[model samples]
Target: MTDDVQAVHQPSDLRTVIMTGASSGIGAKAAATLAEGGAHVVVVGRNTARTKEVASRIGGTAHVADFDRLDEVRDLAQRLLDENPRIDVLANNAGGLVSHRSETTDGFERTLQSNHLAPFLLTRLLLPRIVESAGRVVSTSSTANLFGRVRLDDLNWRKRPWAGGWLAYGTSKLLTNMFISQLAARSPIQAYAFHPGFVSTSFGSDSASMRVLNTLTGGSYGISADAGAVPLATLSGPTTVGVPSGTYFDQLKPYGRQAPQAKDRILAEVVWETSSRLVSIPSDL
Candidate 1:
């Protein structure tokens, strides 16, 4: 362990959890569950009012950040480091499905940047503290990963024509799994990625097609947000609960089926290296 980890040691019962995207949907619900279970939760979201509301309701702290911008993500990480001594869990759950192919101010594809690269930067920035605390990293991946195909050379989808952005969204989820796998391999901290089921939440609200599909399903095609958050809460808790590191959960089941590409170690390393450059972080981190 590093000096940073040793300086902020606390009892196991008083775990400090940092959950991104906690303003609504499964993230908010999971944050509440963790708080109810006695963890000190730090709720991070894009919207100020909603983030503050969730934090106040759960007796947690709120920090607002837009994932589209890497600088904001860095600031969020710095603030987290300054405010907390030890971080027991870092939930990389803030992401969305964009309606069209667009680039963020950071010059990366919107979906890829928001979903994968932003969280990647945050995790790398906070790695030392988390490693020393023996913390876990939990991410919200998806069944959409099955539809994903990652072209390591063009993660931003610049060369391919946008097919209504579903492919981009799917690829981002696949990247989530690869990130967890690589982090587990390289670090001492436990890492997990899970599919929360097809959840009926405000997710994909920006996409008209997704909205139409959700309306047509009438909430029948998926589970509720609260229901979808169970695995997330479970994985992020203090206890390891017998699940090995780097396991991807299909809902609640460990070692769930994943896209063959998601399991390719070489490809995962490539993603790590590529993402490190994209976010201007050290690849070894």
Candidate 2:
């Protein structure tokens, strides 16, 4: 058999996988790895050409949709289910820092909407399909989650002066983790959050702190996006069956202090409730 044929046939039974922000960076790497392993990846991104390029390279399909928009995410989820209902894995990997404290057309904070609310709605919309496949939902959190407080009083950051991009970005990731824990507790479908560590990717590169770090230390502490995608792919794979759901991992192993706030069941419920209200997701989902 030819390599091309093998690539096409390799996870022949693993029908579908969905990866967000898959046009570039760690998300793209995860899509490639999963595709090479024989999963039919549905690459979601903002750029049609870039998304198609990556999708073509992986012998997969591309769906262009911006994560910063909740309506777009809802449309993407519906289209994905209409095309292929039984997605075996949903990788919520699309994330990054926004340059300013902006709001989406839907009126949510840009970073918070993209990193947390978008995925939350996407997951809820697709929850039935994932449950049907008995598949895993893998979310890409960050080491920065450790620094977040998830201020419910200022869920939209309305009262507090927007401290910085990291503040919003970190809070979004922490919300992602909180959502995972809450989902795991209530639903049959398993969910997980993970930190890939500081890979030599474009993450944090556009930030003021990173600019200073780059200036002072030559921007040394980084690993390739390929390295960062490894553990993400593993958790999304079938090998992770039986592992406890809703736990956080760093580089494929369990990680983080599970800070008192992180473990707060009430907080997780509140976060999910607020998330559902903001995104208009069905409570049952």
By TM-score, the best candidate is 1
Tens-place lDDT digits, model 1, residues 60-98: 888888998898999888888887888999999999898
Q: lDDT tens digits, residues 42-99, model 2?
A: 8888877788889899989888888777767777877777777477889998878875
Q: How many backbone clashes does every candidate have?
A: 0, 3
Model 1 CA deviation exceeding 4 Å by range: 1-13
Question: Which runs of model 2 end up more than 4 angstroms from their true locations?
Answer: 1-13, 217-219
| Residue 188 CA displacement from its true place in model 1, Å | 0.5
| Whole-structure CA lDDT of model 1 | 0.88
Q: Model 1 misses residue 228 by how many Å?
A: 0.5
TM-score for each model: 0.94, 0.91
